[model samples]
Target: MNSNNDVIRKLHELTEADMSEAEFLQSVENNMIPMQQFFTYYRCAIMEIETKFRVLNEQFSLNGESNPIEFIQSRIKSYGSIFRKIMTNHIPRNVEAIERDINDIAGIRVVCSFVQDIYRLADCFLRQDDITLIEKKDYINNPKPNGYRSLHLIVAVPIFLENEKRLVKAEVQLRTIAMDFWASLEHKLRYKKDLPPYQLNLLADDLKKCADQSAEWDRRMQDIKNILESN
Candidate 1:
C-alpha cells in the first residue's frame, strides 16, 4: 500500500479517479499547476492568521495575563475533499469554480483554555485591519443537535502574489480545549463507516453525553478563572 503522502500525491497527479495514465498526465498538465498556485495562497493565509494569533500570545505573556489561546491547528483541504464537495454541490468541476465558490479551502482551529477565551481571542483576532470578518457562527451559544460547541468564523485574508494581491476566505473554528477534545472524538466516531446502525446510535448518544460533560467542565474552569482574576 502507498503511504499517506504518496496517496495524496497520486490523486493530485491524477485529477479524476476514472482516468488512465495518459489522461491523468494531460489533466495534470492542464489543471494541477494552477491548483497548486491557488493553494499557495491558502498556505500563506494560514501563516498570516497563525502569526496574528502568535502576536496575541506574545502580548498576553508580556501583560502577565494568562494567554487565551492554548494552541492553533491549520490545514489546506485535501484535493479529494475539494473534488467531492464540488461534485456534491453540483458546481463546475474545475479549479476556477472551486476558487470562486469554496470558502473553506483553508481551515484553522483555535483551541483555547476556557470558553471565554474563545470569544475573547476571536474578538481580538478580527480587530486587526487585515482580517475581514465574512461570517460568524456562535455554536457555543447555540450548540449543535449532537452537543457540539464552537465559534466558527469565515474570514478573508489578503495574500500577495508576485504582481497581485488576492483575498482568500478561510474557516476558523474557535473552541475551548474541552470542546476540541470532544469534537476530535466525535469526528472519529461519526466517520467510522463500518459501524452497525444500533452501534452507531449508541455511540451517538454516548458522544452527546460526553459533549455535555465536557461543556460543564469548561463552565467550571471559567468560573474558577473568574475567581482568580478577581482576587
Candidate 2:
C-alpha cells in the first residue's frame, strides 16, 4: 500500500481483479515498505547535510568576519503531476537508486560579504575530497539576461552509515547579502506585472550597481568590526 491514499485505492482495485485477497495484501505490504524506506532514507540524508552546513557556518562565524549561511533540505510532496511521474514511472523503473536522484534533495545557501567572497567560500566548500563536483554555474560573474546573480553548484557525496554507504547529491548557492535581499524581494512580488519591461531592466541594472556598492560597504563593515575586536 502506497502511503498515498490514491495509490493505495488504485492498487487495491488492480489487485482485486487479479490476485487472491491474502496475496494482494502481502504484495502491498512488501512494495510499500521499500517505497517508504526510499523517502525516509532521503530525508535522513538531507538532515545530515543540513547539520554539516550548520557546523561549518558556525565555525566561520567564530572569526566574526564571515557572512552567515542557511541550509534547507526537504522532500517534494507526492501529490503533483511531477510526483506522479516520479513514482509511477520513475520509481517503478528504479532508474536511479534513490528518488532523491531526481529532485532537489539537499540545498544550501551561503550569504557572503562581497561578490568575491562568494567564489572564495564556494571553492573552499568544494575543496573537500569527499565531495565530488558534478556541475557549476557562476551566475555572479555571468549574470542571467534578467540580471540575476548567484553561484550554483551541484555536488555528489558518499555518505556512510554503519550498515551501508549511499551517494547523495546536494545543490549549493552562494550570494552576497545584497543579492540575497534583492532575490528575496523579487520572489515575494514575482506575480506583479505593473512594472514595464524597460523599468524592470533598469531596476536590474540599478540593483547590480547596488550589489557592487554593498560589497564595498560589507568589506568596510568587516574591517570596522575587526578593529573594534582588536581593541
Q: Which one is best on lDDT?
A: 1
32, model 1: CA deviation in Å? 9.5
Error of 2 at 56 (Å): 2.9
lDDT of 1: 0.81
> Which 10 consecutive residues of model 1 have the lowest summed lDDT?
21-30
lDDT by residue for model 2 over 104-209, one digit each (tens)? 4456666666555666567766787777788898877677655567888877767676799887776677777777887777565443447877887777777667
What TM-score against the true fold does each predicted structure earn? 0.85, 0.58
lDDT of model 2 at position 47: 66
Which regions of candidate 1 deviate over 4 angstroms? 1-33
Which stretches in model 2 have alpha-carbon errors above 4 Å? 1-36, 61-103, 192-231
Residue-level lDDT of model 1, residues 1-231, one tens digit each, is 888755554545334344443432343323544555767889999998889888998898899988888889999876656654654576665566677788888999989898887888888999999899989999998999999999999999998888998898899999988999899988766655566779989988898899999999989988999999899
Locate the minimum summed-lDDT window of 10 residues in model 2.
73-82
